[model samples]
Target: MSIAAVRIIGIDPGSRHTGYGVIESERGRARMIAAGRISTASGTVPQRLLQIQRELAALLHEFTPAEAAIEEVFVNRNVQTALVLGQARGVALCALAQSGLDVAEYAPTQVKLALTGSGRAEKLQVQHMVKVLLNLQGAMAVDASDALAIALTHAQVRGMKARTDALAGGKRWGRA
Candidate 1:
């Protein structure tokens, strides 16, 4: 069976700098399409949220991703920090939902485990595995690499689900 290629968008939402990555997946393989950071350093919180929305909207228009995967917000020791991060994540989710993409949420540890075989893996390890898995060249920004890892994890997990479903239904799995 052959699977049609699917493009997926991954987001790592941050109040100061959000990372995004687009990837194409077919069967069980995934490749990076584009990855970058959305910097909102020069703006207020509201302004930054607007910036994230606008940029994410543009990416949705350009990539037309079939699905989206986002890193679930983690609780920080600082209440202020957690609140700000949640706000950023909310904006990102809103954009994706408005764009009509099916959004999947994954914990940071889940993403790391999917990529590096350990839930407690460090960011550097996740980044390195993402590079190796997608066959990317040169240096990737840490933020972008993390986003790519999220996308990779989604592709892998979704693909597995598709296969499982197909098997349960007594049919061959193709695209998901």
Candidate 2:
């Protein structure tokens, strides 16, 4: 018997550059389908958010992913920056919710730990692991690579849950 593939989308939200990646997972394996950034032009906050919604809507329509994983907003010393980041994350969450995708939020530490076995791993380390895991070539933009890392992390975590659920034979956890 063959298991059907599950499509997952991951987003790294930012007011100026929201990165997205799509992947297909099956039987504990995952492969990248597409990855890119949604670059919003300089404008009012509402205007930028609208652009993000439009772009994300189109991607959701195109892939219709089974689930989505996003990086949770990490507050920094800069209050303004943290607020803006939260807003961007809200917009992203709305977009995914509208599509009815099962969304999972992971902290930066969780993502880093999943990818590099260290919660404090550097960006370059995460990027290199993503490239290797997906068997991709050439350089990848940091934001886009981060999105891919989120997707991969989701797949691994969910895949483990699925197996455990199956072994328990009570009820399956993920989407049916």
RMSD of each: 3.0, 2.5
Model 2 lDDT tens row, 83-154: 988898899999999999889999999999999999999999999999999999998889899999999999
Q: lDDT per prediction?
A: 0.92, 0.92
Residue clash pairs of candidate 2: none
Predicted structure 2, TM vs. truth: 0.94
How displaced is residue 138 in candidate 2, in Å? Answer: 0.7
In model 1, what are the clashing residue pairs, if there are any? none
Q: Candidate 1 regions off by >4 Å?
A: 170-176
| Cα lDDT tens digits for candidate 1, 1-176 | 45678999999999888999999999898988999999999878999999999998999899899999999999979999999999999999999999998899999999999999999999999998998999987887888998999999999998887778767684545633
